[model samples]
Target: METWGFEASNVAVAQVRIEQQLVEAATRAGLTNLRVTTDSEVETIGPTQWLGAEVQANLLWTPTFAFLDALAAWPEGFRVTGFQYEMQPLTPLQQEAGMTAPTGSVRIGVAFPVILPPTAAAPAAAGAGS
Candidate 1:
């Protein structure tokens, strides 16, 4: 089985809405067997101001490679901003038992920064009724 983690950023208004969208997108892409867990409030550490409320999802599936490929092929607007994984080697005996030991499971962590159009920017004030 394959497992992964995902994250999204720069969200406006309700965060749950964005999470639903992502889950829908994944389901539409044939990732039917999905288990998602979310945490709305989170904390960070270290000198960098690298922390914010985050929603994390863990995906599990069979035929790991195919699942990863499908995720990579997500639409342009739905960019997969970040990813990570852990590697574990299997013993020879395990391989012989018809168990396809995972070379590694990729943890996909994405940061979707909602970029509004320039026109959406704040309007400048008229200087002294020019």
Candidate 2:
């Protein structure tokens, strides 16, 4: 599990880029059974509003070095808040399937921030009263 901070032109653009980066990084890291999902949020301060999002990815058979490699691939404005890992003995089915090592899942939480343009009403057309 990991957390990230990002800045983009807009929320939609940010979501697309984040998803792309995550999938690419995961592929490079050799993470199997990768699954990704995202949740969005908004925060306002004074006249400013910020778009926020969280990406959660689940994976199987992720190694330490692989995780590090994926972490390194992220560009600036991104960071890892924390991670969680658990290992358990393989079940009979898994054993028969030739699985040797412990199996577990990973959940990655990534957050993004984007500044939206200020909303305003349109001005009246000229010559309307002329």
Candidate 3:
């Protein structure tokens, strides 16, 4: 096997796409007051180029089964590295608003391979000088 490890250049775009998809999934699952943030990075795994990011989101309540199902069906190249959730105590505002359910925070780590277009090797780089 050969190593095609390379730097990923489309990190920003990938992060935005991930955030959008997460938001959409939350909406579809009826998760309200959704707030999200993402931190993006790149990594090389053998012959693959990957973008790694952590998506942190705060919701009014815990995630539902529908959201988990949607995540399971995420598109190819989208890999779940980690997932965690924390239940937060209700704030004064929430209590005042008659909300009984505690707020929840979720963190999802993901890594997706970057599919790059193939390029023709230069003559000099292809052993022409040898």
Candidate 4:
């Protein structure tokens, strides 16, 4: 991650799984599966933790979650593996939709690689003697 210069945070090991979603028309026509998936797993990682301050790299972005979710089920150190952001007005979009909610080109999402603290299972584990 350092080599790429993209900041890495809350480092942990993550497992990623992929699934395909087939739209109704495609299913009926036996066509290819749609790229869109309803699976929520794409939005989150689990069973993760935050690294100690000693190991922190002073990253620009840190893990964050809703207040309630943080109290109940937030990972120890949630960090985004992928993200998108933009700045735009919310009122016009709301007026167009006849509803009030945040909207814009900007968006942020977390997918997979919810890093966990290194364990002793690996051959070159952290803190292992050289």
Q: Give the winner by TM-score.
A: 2
Worst 10-residue stretch by lDDT in candidate 2? 119-128
For candidate 1, the lDDT comes to 0.39
Residue 13 of model 3: what lDDT? 58
TM-score winner, 3 or 4: 3
lDDT of each: 0.39, 0.52, 0.60, 0.27
Residues 16-37 of candidate 2 have per-residue lDDT tens digits of 7667776777767776676655
Error of 2 at 121 (Å): 18
Q: After superposition, how far is residue 126 of candidate 1 from its true place, in Å?
A: 27
Question: Model 1 segments beyond 4 Å from truth?
Answer: 1-14, 27-76, 101-103, 113-130
**Model 2 TM-score relative to the real fold:** 0.58
Residue pairs in clash, model 4: 12-115, 12-116, 13-116, 86-106
Query: Mind sharing the TM-score for model 3?
Result: 0.57
Candidate 1 structure quality by residue, lDDT tens digits, 9-108: 3223224544565566556544434544332322112211111222233333443445446546644223343556565666788788876755544454
Task: In model 4, state the lDDT of residue 88.
Answer: 46
Report the C-alpha lDDT of model 4 over 13-41, residue by residue, as the tens digit: 12211111112322333222222232221
The regions of model 3 sitting more than 4 angstroms off are 1-9, 59-64, 89-100, 117-130
Assess every candidate by TM-score.
Answer: 0.39, 0.58, 0.57, 0.22
**How many clashing pairs does model 4 include?**
4
The candidate maximizing lDDT is 3
Clashing pairs in 3: none
